[model samples]
Target chain A: MSSTASSTSTQIQLASRPVGWPTPENFRTVTVELPDLAEGEVRVANEFISVDPYMRGRMNDVKSYIPPFALDETMTGGAVGRVIASRAEDLPVGTAVLHQLGWRDIAQAEASAFRQVTEIHGAPLSLHLGILGMTGLTAYVGLTRIAGLRSGETVFISGAAGAVGSAAGQIARLLGAERVIGSAGSAEKVELLTSKYGFDAALNYKDAPVREQLPELALDGVDVFFDNVGGDHLEAALDVMNTGGRLALCGAIASYNAEEPTPGPDNLSALITRSLRMEGFTLGGHFDLADEYAQRMTEWFAAGEIAYDETVVGGIDHAVDAFLGMMQGQNTGKMVVRTA
Target chain B: MSSTASSTSTQIQLASRPVGWPTPENFRTVTVELPDLAEGEVRVANEFISVDPYMRGRMNDVKSYIPPFALDETMTGGAVGRVIASRAEDLPVGTAVLHQLGWRDIAQAEASAFRQVTEIHGAPLSLHLGILGMTGLTAYVGLTRIAGLRSGETVFISGAAGAVGSAAGQIARLLGAERVIGSAGSAEKVELLTSKYGFDAALNYKDAPVREQLPELALDGVDVFFDNVGGDHLEAALDVMNTGGRLALCGAIASYNAEEPTPGPDNLSALITRSLRMEGFTLGGHFDLADEYAQRMTEWFAAGEIAYDETVVGGIDHAVDAFLGMMQGQNTGKMVVRTA
Candidate 1:
């Protein structure tokens, strides 16, 4: 826990932009020399670093909601760490902090670049990267703000075993959604969704076509859909949505690796015929909901009303592997790498 | 003017449902003898019966926003008529009325079935089917209520020469849209969109692929998209949309006659990456805005702020011809038949 100058930081840098699916060849591990902390600067030793699906979109050279990750730069994303060296009073040494300068074991930046964080209800530090951080906020905002999931409504969530989807299912239930439906890739995850996540029903898309299975499960018709996997999931949701349904387009992990642009849902006419609404959003402007979300989430965490799962990998060297695994649907929930 | 009954009404009824594009063989005309008007009912002499793109969707037996047209029934839609005789005091003789009892020379129904209307600023009764009735109200609701178009935002309208699209372009301009772009199928209609409809830019989709052309015209990216033609038009709009853009899904004339479900947009990932919103709506729940729309449209018409074109066929005998012609992109704005 030395807060000294002249230390070295290990980081994973982008070597080349992948045309379709990313591989280890796309990233290169490098070490950077650190200098003495300047005025208002802080040095953090990361405890855990997050790997998310949206990062796959950023890895491409194309412009998006977030700028593309520049070639030959250290990857950045959500991370939780402890301030080991600080020249600023706000982030004193030993205070836990969260930031975007990730895919590294050490981050040294101005104090303003880091946000102070603390563990809730004795949860692990990785919890900040999962249920208590952007992952949780995404689920909350998609349900309440984007899709406006009302009480007594049924919610259908695609990619239900992943970070955002898993959290969305529990949040929808806690928010008074009468029925929560989820779709996953594996039988184990399908069982977990119903047994552990309070989902009313779950679909293993690998079993039967979602087009056939969804209509059977959603007898009342989905009133709200939190979609993380687009394509066929969107088409199926369009087929069975109730009149005036709402869809929150959070991700399209299904098409992230498709080299060619994938076709969208074929039944979009359902929009006009059923009066459906589909909106896509990022967490940028909705940071104002953080205070409300944190407050409620803190209580829920204490009452044991919220549950989450994480696929953890050891060492910063495996960060890219974790990301690739998550993208391949190998991870059941939030995928994070322990950097310390 | 004869106020007495005992006349016969010429009616067109559905003989068979079209599998794709409708042809005359699917319809049959019948002459029905009229008895004296029953209590609470009125006898209306049809003045003009309207033909619209949406009628094609109703021709299918599949359930939609509006119930599918039943077999062997008169094709009901927008019709304006004069009350020739009435047992209901509210709809006395000489009253001009608009009702959905179309495809006929006369309609006899309860007084409540008709909405009393008059010409605006001495405009012809055809205005009721074009810019002052459901057509105009659709543009108003799509721009204001559904898309939530803002002042100074740019708007792009597909099918800009048709009734709803033509009306949307003018209404967007009046609502303070900084730039308005339109797309039509023919060179003549494209020229008319900018020259007569006040669109800042217009594209002939037939000249080039919309995906290639739209990005050039919508250089700043579209903020509000009022879509009447789906498929390639929707795919193009998805490509050039700005951050936080809104799309109102009004109609999909492009695929209404398709024998099979057509593939949707190929780049729906834009929905998430750009933080865009796409909504589908019908006028059923939004007719409450009709009074507000009527007031504003009447003023625009009176002040010469509205311009419209109609392709009127001679008799109800060509009603099917007019509808087929409109579907073939022949009509500039409203298409109607003089039933009387």
Candidate 2:
């Protein structure tokens, strides 16, 4: 290994905006010199980087729940890292922490921006960012608070193989849901949903049109629909929702890259006929509920009542590729970049 | 005064389905002979009748939360009347009550089918079917439970001069909404919204397109949208909703008469960006909260904190004409037909 004096930091920054889908040309990797730590700031050597569909929305310059990222800035997201130098009391050198440090091998941030991982109840450090972090909180608040999901209700989750979707499916089942159906884009995902994740049934959306298949899959009609993929998936879900159905609108990956706005479905009349409730929310907006969610998720993980999976890519140099690929539906579960 | 023995009953049935908009030709008034009351049944001498937009949905044969009216059957709706004669122990002569007795001047109903109004509250019989009945309860449950409306939120009510909309506007104001905006079809109704009902602002939808007018009228953005007209009005609300806005979808009067379903604006993207929540509901499903709503509304009325208006049409002979007129937006506030 190279001496500390010879080691340097590597980073990827937004080079340009894409017209529709982003490409490699839109991003560039650069080597940067490190600066001395400032007061109350700790220097981190990143070990894992997160890539999520929400990042696609941030790349656009339109108004959204979260502000758009500035041009030529380091594309920011959640990461797990180890502190190399510290000037703060809470975080010391060699402590593992999670933060929104973006796609960089090394970062200096206010110690308060980072949450120290203490291996609580013998949990892994990566699980801190996956099941016990933003992703887990999203599924929890959406099902219990937004949807008001009741026991014995049926839940159907679209994009069921993704990070948030997988967590939602299991939690709904554990919460006494009578049936849980899931839709994924691949057969491998379908198998994982039923075999490993405890989903009652899983369908490969690529095998059949969801409009035709969804009704047959959910014969009793869906009481709650956790939607991650909007557009056609929303239209299809609307067609089969029961009277008094509740839809938790979490993400819309399908429209994130559309060149033009998708037209409203002809079936909105169903909203009146069925008396459905559809609500949209962001995990960041629900941060106040984090402590409650962390406690519950911790208990579930400790009891082995819940499990999670992650796809880790090696090295910070490959962070951009992993991110782009995940957005393109290449990853089977949560995609995280591990910097060696 | 004529003796009760000579009183004959008249009923109106749906003669044919309307192609675009219902006309007199779609209904046929018939004279029906009186039937003797059986044990546990009572004869209701119809005193007032209610004509509403929800009846339009029942005319269609499509599946809905409420069963559709069969061809050649008397159109079903809420009606208030005096119990002329009774064979039941609980109900007696001269008691005013409310029931789903359909479009008829006189009807024979089981005592369980009607609720005694005069015994519970010493208010006018018409109040049992309008302000203190389904219309009032709808506004109460929608604002409190469905919309999760907080005090001081700004509200915009569509179809603001109509039955449920009128009630919703006043309730929003009484509940401490800072700004209440309403939209009606006629200029006269707009004036009534602001002057008589205490709405902060009112607009005549026929004067200008709602799409352009909404943003100008609601400069701060709408926090809650009480939607009675769901086509362009819903689209306009989507354009001006504040972050975390809540929409209470009570009815879709704009689409009730469409020959084919109209395509409204595509709004799924807006839902994600604004983090809005839209829920549709009917009053009958929320009957459990009726007692609580009635107590609150009664207190508000007695204290002069809330007020209501009605459009009364005299005589059962003109019931069809009144029903058609109300559906065409000719009536202001709640439309009630006085049969006595």
Using DockQ, give the best candidate's number: 1
lDDT of each: 0.91, 0.84
Top candidate when judged by TM-score against the true structure: 1
| B76 Cα displacement, candidate 2 (Å) | 2.0
What global local distance difference test value does model 2 have? Answer: 0.84
Model 2 lDDT per residue over B110-138, tens place: 89988888444445678767788898898
lDDT of 2 by residue, A1-340 (tens): 1135223578888888777888888888988777666789888888787888898888888888889877888888888888888889888888899899788888777899898875765665667667778888888888998888999999999998888999999999878899999999988899999999999998888998889889988999999999999877888899999998999999988878888866666677787678899998887587888888888887888789886788888888888788878887777768888886
Q: Roughly what TM-score does model 1 have, to 2 decimal places? A: 0.98
RMSD of 2: 3.0
Interface RMSD values for all candidates = 0.7, 1.6
**Candidate 1: residue pairs that collide:** none
The residue-level lDDT of candidate 1 at A151 comes to 96
Task: Give the DockQ-based CAPRI class for model 2.
Answer: medium
What clash pairs does model 2 have?
Answer: none
